[model samples]
Target: MSTSYDITQDKWERFTFSREGRVLTAAITSDHPVNGVDEQMHTELALVFNCLQRDSESDIIILTAKGRAFCAGGDFDWFEEQINHPERFRAIGWDAKQIVTTLLNMEKPILCRMNGAAAGLGATIALLCDIIIADETAKIGDPHVKVGLVAGDGGALIWPQLIGFAKAKELLMTGDLLTAKEAERIGLINYAVPAAELDAKVAELVAKLQANPKWAVRWTKTTANIPLRALAAQLMDASIGWESVSNYLGDRREAVAAFKEKRAPKLTGE
Candidate 1:
């Protein structure tokens, strides 16, 4: 039917109609890249989510990307813009809300194919997926603390549920990177396979899910995902609020400065 949104930008970002059935596949290219959740990307992603939701023929969605990194998370340029003009912070908050809401509420199963390193919101996106399949060599982290920001939107909602409160705190507080196996071991991801086998593994999983009775699958998925939805509803706002305030604070400023200078950050409560 409406293949219009099926592919807006060829490899930049696209939805490929699967030959097997009603499953829609999305590829996020590493070249044109998403530098975190910015305005244009946010809008386009929302459009993609909406399109996927409306496509009745689509029973499952798979998100994967090109390159050695899945998503680096928020564009520092946008963050720089926000710091320079604190008034625009609310928009970022709204975008964060929308991104989480769209993924959490998707009626069909959403799977993440983590082909490479994913940090910050990138890791968040993977965690939101119904099933996350990562390459054994791939690394994932939530480095908001390293960037002088709080775990806020993504970490605040999902980390505790995935790995328990203590480990989540340790990782989030230190901004530690977890190998794919460690991620799976900690329950952060579903499986960790060889990088070369990632696509095949993901296909096998998606196909299996797709071939199952649609209603039974959907109901099971819907029930299981309710906890995530509830967590987001209760925690995301407060988390984003702290993150917005962090943008105006010294820790984030030092963090960004250190990143730009390629040096260690020196944080001060001020």
Candidate 2:
């Protein structure tokens, strides 16, 4: 059988296959305190997905990080670059969207092991996973609104579906960090286990999946995802457009500035 994932290194990340059959792993190493999906990370993720797709033997993917935080979301430097290059911003937005879509449509099961704090796009991807197992101590939230962006990507689409619109709206609007246990209670995550037990739990789940008929498993996932796929195809663009436009608005400008200043954001009618 072909290897699950060919090990590779980029400037700030690494990709490899787990010993378990059909499981892929990505390890990101950044000098910063937390990892951010900058342009380079986006390119690496795209390549990783393509590589995983080409390897027909692969049947499962587990995305985990190696720091105190899973991902801190966008790189400010990259964001600044996008601000300077609006065309590039649009292209990057579409590219990032493609990455999420690819994961959603992958033939194999996708499990997200949220080992640590997950925010913004990190939280978005975690929610999109077929299974989400979080470290009991982890906190997950969408801080996009805190930064003046609409909770685009999968946040607006999945949160409401998973937890109902009322709760989703409150959390997304407030940017509150939900504890893992709380996350599970709200149906935001599958399970919250001790930090040490996280990997083992994921392995157990994967084993269960691996033991099942691959075709049947894949078909079940594909069928269940059809609704999510349709929802995304229908609403993702409008949500992203709203988010992108929000970036240029006075409220978002103040939001980012407040974040930088470590102060509560004050919004004024614009």
Candidate 3:
């Protein structure tokens, strides 16, 4: 445990990283209203896991955001950039794959503090966490289909694993969000507590994990993540590829426009 990495020194424009004793926390600090995952935030998230994994100071990593929403979704303006300049989607597609793989492969446990609403890639990130403690006001969903893209990033793999294929398919196809309690009941998340109690609940779990044998805790996580890592290895490339292809060919422009305009999208599958 001699690895000496200081994540707080990184020039992170999209997040604020800090450590408290053995617990390192990365808080998404996007300027967007709901802390949308724009290009910068997505890139930072893709790289942060590696730092956290190597940092010996952190026994547990707590992921959260500094807004009313964990992450509402992608930055619509950025999505528009992908639609308008399809060439950029390739880089972002690779980033999407990295975000999932890096987080999954980390030996240190990650606990998601779902303090508010999470949707699209945000939902996938939260669900893929080792443990999720969500505030009751938080809602979660993978609305990629609603925005005319497949739930390809990580949702297609993890949702069915967490909740069952039937329910996963229904939710993925509809792109509907679930309340925190509903998500917990459906087995999509670990726990959902009142907003005021969210920090206390996470702190309790952190203390319990920290009090145990560190290597054993990390090894248990490593063992449990084997299956997920294998599945992700098999599916991430193809899924992210097709997601890029969909962005190149699908009715994403119309769907996004409709969303911003508050109107029905005329999707012809072009």
Candidate 4:
């Protein structure tokens, strides 16, 4: 008999969790126009994976969002706060590390239902998933450099692994967004299907995994993630440290200010 792990007991302000049979779907439910990550959401993102990992009732986990966009990136208000109080940004290094590490440590296979655009940390989360199925109209990218920050979250670690170092450098440096089709062409994501077919495709993949031996499937994912876990251990601290330094830079302030004022950032190479 399957033991029930009550997910509702975990109060999440920006996320909602629900399970059907043994598949738990964790969604980004922030009311932001694009579901941007704020301080609260970031904390929840770091903790949600651990919660889901402990859900013995779940065999598969689907990471998705409730709005038109999966997650557009960081909230502009939150960005400004980090820029203004660089010390506040320091505390997020642990949460940032936890987000990536816990997801990597999860034994259950994660399928990213990329319902819409995913940028910055959103893209990192999607790319780290074992399989990614995106809506054909959606876009994916790590635009951290656009806002004068290093793509140091999981972007540095996962992008290079998925699409190779040369392409990853070009995109991360330029802060370019790729259409779902282009992302698939470059092997950054698994499948780009019509929006209407997104759920059907995810269900199909879920069914295939459910048919297999449970431990065998779970252990296979754990084995496949060994190298990724090693890379995360090696790079996360330095990357997050550099990102924190960028938070204190004049360029970061200018970028956030420009975003809020609806103007181009006047960035000097400060």
Candidate 5:
């Protein structure tokens, strides 16, 4: 690993990056209150992993948020923007696909530090990591259908495999948020510790991952993720396209409007 290798020049606006020893931490530093994914942030999410893989000084990475919450899903304001600029979503769909693929392709393990609430795309990212350790106070779910959008952004692909198809469908369709304990009990995430000890739990696991023979850990992760890789290859493009298409239909609009208006959406099934 060359110390001269650099990720500082990358200039990521929505995130801040730092490395200590072999552990690189990427903190979602968005000021949007809830750290939702916008076009730019979404693009970064797709590309950042590859850059870290090339960073010679890094062996494993921790993905977390700086704000009180992790990503809350797509920005509501951005979702509204898609109503008039629906075509833009096609590009986002492509990026979403890349995010999943690149993460799977990376050799180094990723440990998700779910410090707070995670939903929609956030939940997908956390659940997709090699190890997910969350604060007991946090919650997780893919509530895309509640917002009248398909869980096309890796949600449809990852959830069923992590849990089962039956449980996956029930949560996605119902848009229910699970407490961290509940999620772990259902086998949706790896561990849930009290908020006070989250950092310790994360460090313990990171040490375990880092101390193991690097090649073995990386290869084991890669081979174990093979079935997930195939499913993503088979389902992602079509699922994302279906999700993009849903943005044009009336229900999606209604859902966004209702959330902003703080009222129940009236779905006509149009």
Candidate 6:
């Protein structure tokens, strides 16, 4: 008799999980206007990966979102709260570390179904996946610096490893967005297909992974992740610390205020 791993029992307010055979799809289902990350979503993101990793029935995991954008970075309202309350931002440092470490530690293969724009932490999550198949129209980038914050939440760790340090430094420093096609060309992502073909392409890749020997595929992913895991361990705490420190900086406050006023941020670089 097969042991059942009922994913429905995994109660998550911001995420929904559904399984098709041994392949599970975990989607971000936030109701924010842009499906942005808030306090609840951030906490859930840190916890949900562990739950998915524990699901014995799922051999492959697909990370995606329900709406147009995968995740449109951090919610502005939440950003405001963090700016006003240093303790609140500092409190989430553990969750930030957990999100990166748990993801790197997972043995199962993960595929990102990039339905639309994925910026900042959203970009970090998608990039951390083992295989990323993005819609041609989708955009991906870590624009933490744009808001005067550090891209310490796995962005710094993964980008350099994926596309090399030189290009990674340029993008992270500038906080520029890249077309999915450009991402693929730069080897930052695996495939960029037409919007209409995104689902079909993801399904094809899932089938290919399922056809391989289960342990071999899982262990191969684990083996490949060893270096990444080490890097994450060394860098996550310090990066998250810097991001927290940034929340109290004048530049971050100005960035948020300018965003609300729909004007340019005159960052003093303080």
In model 3, which regions exceed 4 Å deviation? none
Please give the TM-score that candidate 4 achieves against the real structure: 0.97
Count the clashes in each prediction.
3, 0, 0, 0, 0, 0
Which of the predicted structures, 1 or 5, would earn the higher lDDT when compared with the native?
Answer: 5
TM-score against truth, every candidate: 0.90, 0.89, 0.97, 0.97, 0.97, 0.97
lDDT tens readout by residue for model 1, 1-270 = 455444333333433344346667776653435435565665556556656666656678888776677777767777777777887876767777877888888878888989888889889888888999999988898988887788886787888889999999999999999999999998999999998899899889987986789889988988888888888888889999988888788778878888988998787777
Q: Candidate 4 lDDT, tens digit per residue, 75-118?
A: 98899888778888998999999999999999999999999999
lDDT of 3 at 128: 84
Report the C-alpha lDDT of model 3 over 9-34, residue by residue, as the tens digit.
76889889777888888998977999
Choose 2 or 6, whichever is better by lDDT: 6
Error of 4 at 30 (Å): 1.1
lDDT (Cα atoms) of all candidates against the true structure: 0.78, 0.77, 0.90, 0.93, 0.88, 0.92
Q: Can you give the lDDT of residue 79 in candidate 2?
A: 65
Instruction: Report the Cα lDDT for residue 146, model 3.
Output: 86
Error of 3 at 29 (Å): 0.4
Arrange candidates, best lDDT first. Answer: 4, 6, 3, 5, 1, 2
> Which regions in candidate 4 have their CA more than 4 angstroms from the true location?
1-4
Estimate, for each residue in 1-270, the C-alpha lDDT of model 6 and write its tens digit. 776656669678998888798899999997886689999999998888888888877889999999899998999999999999889999999999999989988999999999999999999999989999999999999999888898888899999999999999999999999999999999999999999999999999999999999999999999999999999989998999989988999999999899889999997769
Lowest-lDDT window of 10 residues in candidate 6?
Answer: 2-11
What's the true lDDT of residue 134 in model 1?
Answer: 95
Off by over 4 Å in 5: 1-4
